[model samples]
Target: MPFLTSPVLPEGTLSRRPQPDIPAAAGLLLRPWRPEDAPAVHAAFQDPVLHQWHVRSSESEEEAAGWIEGWRSEWARECDAQWAVVHADTGELRGRAALREIRLRDGVAEVAYWTVARARGQGVARHATDALVRWAFQEIGFNRLELMHATANEASCRVATKTGFAVEGTRRRALLHPDGWHDMHLHARLRGD
Candidate 1:
């Protein structure tokens, strides 16, 4: 399939809009990324497990700090919204949640997330994802949200299913992973439909 590009996403997706920090779940909070959180974010992503699971680049503390600057700029400009997950009890930074591919034409956006392995199996991701969807629909006025996972990621698929994201279909050779092209399972949720 052709790439689903939307002018609404790039033109004014984050243009001078107010995006308030919101809590994601009961045990975890989802808020904007902060400069102080850079060290912890770097440390969390340093785990080999997280890198392997998400297939993202390994970064040093300095690199993480630089990336945090990008998130800050987006938040300040209202371009792309990103959130950091923190444990309510210990205040430990657990992971990240983001709303990307935001398109106002269809009233939809794509959601993405990743968490430290230590935080897995505790429903941290599920809580963050569900809460993000709720906020996106209710507050952001988005009518739909999509999540895509690699076929090999059963845990992600499980979370998508558990959160009422329907398995829309599969796109063969859709994503270029570290190894090669891989199929992706598409999941979707609609607002008040």
Candidate 2:
């Protein structure tokens, strides 16, 4: 493709800087996933609700460690950013949040998150998501961010709405879950919004 505009944020813009722990809300934070958190990651995957949506099992602490290592690598490569949602003081893992499908030239990415069974009703996902959106847009210069989930995921829809990601539309047969193809809702937020 012929060149038009430069990348909105240059390569290494994110990777070169140390990823700081972002305070999500009272008693919560978004921090880089650590190898030591592998056990918690594995445990969270055991939750049927989380596993149902993710459709992947950690299987063992070793596999969970691999996943955390990969997340670290993605941050270093500026390909994607993933964080562990945890207690600020205790460092207990509560969930996860990520900016996936990154497009540096377009200044866009998709948001993804899941919470532990014990943390589901405690606002972990919502607070973590709100903090991540602020960092992605205000601090990191993403022009827009998208949140997508199966139409049946009402909890996710609520989080999206509360975070100001307006419903753009629904995509037909967009994702394959264990139950087969699912229509997905595409929600988005612009920097100015």
Candidate 3:
């Protein structure tokens, strides 16, 4: 079928929360954020890496709880889906992986992720990202998925590459940070890729 003739998602298909639990590779699990995870979530956001790259952090447990609550509303609106990356054996919160900027009509979305301090260098982000990308392409029928990170975030760049995203190009001064504007590396993968 031609591009324009390709069928898009049915109406109401993305207007509610999706199945909350998804199993991932390397004994990782992706599930919706829970209220009880506030403490861990707050602690994870305290990592300086999150502050340096993400430019935002939850200062307190209450703030983290609010962040967790916001994910449910975002799911209801179909704008994003955020999952808690957890260890299967210990059930510990390892990180987060999300598909944001979901445009059902265009079959495109953006993937983003962050790892807890203790989970760094453990392939937590890469495994969770790969699993989410696969689910987005196969289950959600997204044609294209994007992963953009500050050019200085070498670790995230590696995760994107490992998850089969190709570095398409750089968007200069595309992201604002606490320090200043930073160039962003744009990576993407298609369903056929």
Candidate 4:
């Protein structure tokens, strides 16, 4: 079951919203994506490490520019909330992270994210995911949050564990990876679970 076909989409935001001016983390921040970020963002995708973990196609300068524009517009529309990984001390864009598929049902939402290859294993994804989870559980009032990763993505599995997402179980062939259907490891972190 590709997440794209999941009934979850029906319960989540299908539009955009006014962009929030989020700062980098208190110690490490994850701010909203910006147009000026295209250059570095374009370069970041060139990292082969990122390609192996990310499911999407590599980007060109134009694509990166367009992506930034799209996220900005989506932010204004309240459809998707996207953010950039930045160093809290210098405020430099290190990568990008997101918490998507937000569904409001019985006070719960699911979260997902990625970081530039260079930023992996540096606690970048953890900080960014933590920020979003905090917002969903605290600010957004969601009581439960979920995450799923392809079984082959060991780094993601590690990230989920490090960030407190529990190993829920494995869903055989749950996602359609580039090659074909792949099993996925389901992980979750609830408000009081």
| Best-matching candidate per lDDT | 2
lDDT (10s digit) by residue, model 4, range 28-110: 67777778888888888787766665666645878988988887666544445678778878767666766555554445555
Clashes in candidate 3: how many? 0
lDDT score for candidate 3 against the true structure: 0.88
lDDT (C-alpha) at residue 128 in model 3 = 97
Clashing pairs in 3: none
Name every residue pair that clashes in candidate 1. 14-78, 14-79
Tell me the tens digit of each residue's lDDT in model 2 across 90-184: 99899999999888888999999999998888888889999999999888999989999989889999999999999999999998777788899
lDDT of 1: 0.79
The sequence of per-residue lDDT tens digits that candidate 1 reaches over residues 21-133 is: 66766688888788888788888877876665566664688888888889777765544578888886777887888887666666767888888768888888899998888
The superposed Cα distance between candidate 3 and the true structure at residue 178, in angstroms, equals: 0.6
Give the TM-score of each candidate: 0.86, 0.97, 0.94, 0.80
lDDT of 2: 0.91
| Model 3 vs. true fold: TM | 0.94
Models sorted by TM-score, best on top: 2, 3, 1, 4
TM-score of 4: 0.80
Candidate 3 ranges with C-alpha deviation above 4 Å? 1-7
Q: Say which candidate scores most in TM-score.
A: 2
Every candidate's lDDT = 0.79, 0.91, 0.88, 0.70
Ordered by lDDT, highest first, the candidates read 2, 3, 1, 4
- lDDT (10s digit) by residue, model 3, range 122-142: 999989998898888887788
